[model samples]
Target: MNRSSFRSVLYLAAILPFFFSDCKKSSSGPASGSGGNGYYTRFKMNGSSVEYDSQPFAGITLLKSDSLYTCVMVAYKDVNAGLKNAVTIIIYSANPIAANVGYNDPLKSRRSNGIMVPQTTIFWYDSTGTGYLTAGEFADNTGNTGIAGVIANAKLTITEMTSASVKGTFSGTVYRSDLARSAAITDGEFYLKRSQ
Candidate 1:
């Protein structure tokens, strides 16, 4: 397979397990005083709101490199009718992450380990099939078209970070390369605990 295709496959392989794995619940509940079962991801896409709450498994993880740290937060709804979907937010930094900080630059091409980071570097996926992300070379199952949010128009900010949970907000634009269609993502917010 070509490089881009290979990267796409690798990305899928890494996250696919989260969809199928029988994850154990964390001992602690949602961040203290955060409210609502302590786990939720909600946002608006193209003016419509898409929300998921009380996910069976959702949390933030820290990936450490020599001197860099990537905070990855993932939230997904249980598979319904065999469809798999989720949203992921990754924050890369040279130092420990803090609240009120924004990560990812829209003006620069986002790459990690030689792979293009998902739209906004924060991504949303649905199995029903849509073609977005032409600029980033992301394609759908058919390999002909795909969809990805725009990094240049995207931003994610950590609103709160505590020992038990993390809260954040994000916004961006997503594009379908095949149709030249675009959608706005606004009022995105999430609260999750440290992945166990």
Candidate 2:
């Protein structure tokens, strides 16, 4: 495997255990809009809307292993006072992802950027207190407590992007491996500076 493939595998290895483990929901603070920083991402977690911006959003990072591999990362933390809950989104692609194009399968894994799957898997790190990462799927969580595929029908839409910055909107259903529960995440948008 190449460097990108190696990194991807490493990440998968690190988070696999969390998929089978049980998840303890952490308390979250008030969701706020952009704090003067033109970036904010909001989504409904089990029907409740949560927002994160530059102030509590922490930072965003972009990484590339080669021409065929790219990763976009966003982090959020410290919302409520003394609250340890945090969230992260890692978007990985094989080809050079451009704006306006809908990348499907936001929950399935591909061997490489050129290779396409029915779904694209996005890494989700829920570091509320007991930090855990999972290759969650994009699927609806209505009455089910455990997810079959983790996530389904995951789609990411990029509204703006550049070497120095990336802006986009993403919406999907997320599934948890620890349990059969899922969350309907919609109207999720973000604008972030590219970090080296």
Candidate 3:
């Protein structure tokens, strides 16, 4: 074969895999049946209702990261047609104990004995318009541009947990890391099907 033809063949070989691979739809979150009547996670943020109730698109995952267990849930809430909004919650546990009802943990500023309460991070992403509300931003709700909040007075509860599903509630108060402002979160609950 001519050198030009050989080079063209090599280029196509390299590019074809990527083209085909891209056809697969990437999973948006944990493994749960889409549109199942069993999954829901909702809360009030800044006096507005934030919910991730769609099935198949919302799910939960529990995996160990180093010595700590990582529990994560992602909910896809439709804010518009053809566009999506998402809320992500990640919690770091010192142990694998099921977070069942009335299960509560205090969130402190420093870690102690492998336990870091308030070691959780929550993210709110509006893929269609407004920016995201990160764990740090939630901790810095005082309207001060120069200072961050110190996370404290936080409590998280897992109302139910199993290998196949998980349910929980959480609330807390966070002060800016700079001590500039603070935000309050209350009455939060989530029930998700475990895919992993």
Supply every candidate's count of residue pairs whose N, Cα or C atoms clash at under 3 angstroms.
Answer: 7, 22, 14
Local accuracy of candidate 3 as per-residue lDDT tens digits, 1-196? 2334323432332332232221123356433333457677677765667676654122332343445555556555641221245455556555553565232233322334543333455444444522222232223222222323333334456777777677887665433222343445567777876654
Q: What is the Cα-based TM-score of model 3?
A: 0.54
Q: Model-by-model lDDT, in order?
A: 0.53, 0.46, 0.46
Worst 10 residues of 2 by lDDT: 136-145
Mind giving the per-residue lDDT tens digits that candidate 2 earns over 1-196? 1334434543563453233222222444334333466655566655677665523221222234333334444434433322233345555455566678676553333543444333334433354333233333323222221434443555677778777667777666653433344456667666665553
Ranking by lDDT, best first?
1, 2, 3
The best candidate by lDDT is 1
TM-score winner between 1 and 2, please give it: 1
The weakest ten consecutive residues by lDDT in model 3 span: 16-25
Best by TM-score: 1
C-alpha TM-scores of all predictions: 0.63, 0.57, 0.54
Q: How many backbone overlaps does candidate 3 show?
A: 14
